[model samples]
Target: MAEKEFENKVALVTGGSRGIGAAIALRFAGSGAEVFVNHRKGAGSSKAKAEELQERVALMGGRLTAVASDISSRSAVKEMMETIGREAGRLDFLILNAARAPFKPIERLLERELRDLIQVNYMGNIFCVQEALPLLEESAGKIVFISSLGSRFFNPAYPLGSMKAAMEAVVRDLAESLRPRRVTVNAVSGGIVKTDSYKVLRQHMENLDQLPEHLVVEAEEIADVTAFLCSPAARGICGQTIVCDRGMSNALQRF
Candidate 1:
């Protein structure tokens, strides 16, 4: 791919202080896009990660800005959008990568916990898109949501899965609704990723070698796909949940 595929474009990645979100922000910066790395908190490792990304972009002669905001709150998201508009004037890509939910059985979860998950994972995404729609439309941009295979499979029974399923539906509906405006919306559903969020699951599973290579998708791998989806190369794709699970979903069979 050309180095300047995303030249003159601007991207916003939520929860971009570390892990997959950090990787996505770096990839965008590498591709010559001005990236906004959004984190909910501004302390400790998250702050360090943001600083590291800023340094990387500087070394690469790219543009990167780290913004702190809680995506689940409407006022915060509004403020974020306002900052982007003021600073960059327009947005070419929006990656909804912030997801928060406690790991627990459905019965054990309190009503507040479930609502929080829905608010952060589902409504947060909706809010980001709602706030970013006009800018995206102006730039003919794309929106990518980082989803999980849990939405399709039966494993990892948590309230998060239910929220993911609902979010996928929203992705489809939004894609269709935004089609007329030349704004594309899609979800990249990944398998078990090696991130802090997966530590709990890793403890229960033994013999990692038994899993397919594709099943262990990396942060960089997902970041690459996200960069592509934001580029002109993915203009033909829209309203689809592209699974990056290394055929894990296909490998499962039932009689």
Candidate 2:
């Protein structure tokens, strides 16, 4: 509950260039955590924007490092972990926020689409956790995987929902398995975050506009919850998916 509670702690946030990941990265930096903002850079990637973010984060008081690695690649993840270990001997927090997917109907899913879905959404996170284990073990690190309402509430066109749901299960499983080691695992299933992803999602789901303004979840709100989960105050909580949707999940089927 004190200011700069994360002083000297090390945190890694995937997809931290913008949106919820950005909010989480800034939150950690502002709280005095050394932040590593990780992004994927290649064709059509936001390498420029990510670099700009790196510059902005460096201006903050906390130590900041902008890293680019394809989470889907085992070698890339290994290299990323090596860099972190070389620079900072330990990692205190690993926020799983990066997600790459092509939103489409499940029925129309192609072989390539399915493979990528597993690679980027599911296996990608697995690789991060596996690679981060050593550094995290050294520090008893906290892990928070960002999820969405689609994981629970069915979205016909939201193909990423399945992956989100799968990670939540992983969170629960790892939370118990790693408890003896002092590591914590949890998930935050946000609702209707109006980020750039939402813009793309709107094209697939028309009902987005119909949701009440009060039901929307903000990136900063998600960031704060995530920060709390990583803090000592939340040590009592684990293996849970905290919903931050302004009661939106209960708002449906209104009279």
Candidate 3:
């Protein structure tokens, strides 16, 4: 692929301040696309990381703009899309990578936790899609949701799985509904990615360290596949959730 394959294009990645979202932002920016990295609205680690990502992209001669928004709020999402339009004029890719949920069983979740689980992980992402629809349709763009194996398999304390599952269903529905408009919708179900959150998960699922080295999936690997889904190569694929888990999801394993 040419270094500037996405020249003049624009992409927005939610939760792009760190981890898989950060990698995806770098991937698109590295390919010469102007990227908008979305972080939750606040000053703290998330904002710091977004700034760091911006500097890194600048060092690489890539363009990135950090946008702050709480996707759970429809009003915030709307303002974000408006900002992107006013600044970038067009959007070619929308990566639904933002998610927020506590690590705990569904049955044990408190009222607040339950609301957050549904609001941020599920409704928040859907809100982005709804807000970005106009720009996407104008550009006939692509949308990719960042999902996980938790959506299919039962994890020790992963209530987030239910939301991922729901978003995957939305992906299917949107793919069909947006087909005529040439807006493609898809997802990537990652497996056991060693992100910052992994440290927290380790406390609950001690066996994560026991998985074979070869089974570990890198953030960049997921980003590469995500880029493919947004490229011309994936024009034929729609309403599909591609699993980029390094075969970890193929069968049961003894830890």
Per-residue lDDT tens digits of candidate 1, residues 1-255? 665878899999999988899899989988888999999887888788888989988999998999989989999999999999999999999999998888776788888987888789988888999999989999988999998877877654456778789888988999999999989999898877788777766554444436655467889988988888887788888888888876667765621
> Model 3: number of clashes?
0
lDDT for each residue of candidate 2 in 1-255, tens digit (9 for 90 to 100): 676789889999998878899999989989999888888884345777676666777777467787888999989999998999999888999999999888898889999999999999999999999999988988989999999887888887888999999999999999999888888999998988888888999888877788778778889999999999999999899999999988888855722
| Candidate that would win on lDDT | 3
In model 1, where is the ten-residue run with the lowest total lDDT? Answer: 200-209
Off by over 4 Å in 2: 1-3, 42-45
lDDT of 3 by residue, 215-250 (tens): 889999999999999999888899999999988878
Q: Residue 132 of model 1: what lDDT?
A: 95
Please list the C-alpha lDDT of all candidates, in the order they appear: 0.86, 0.89, 0.93
Inter-residue clash pairs, candidate 2: none
| Candidate 2 local distance difference test against the native | 0.89
Please identify model 1 stretches exceeding 4 Å from their true place: 1-3, 204-214, 253-255
Ranking by lDDT: 3, 2, 1
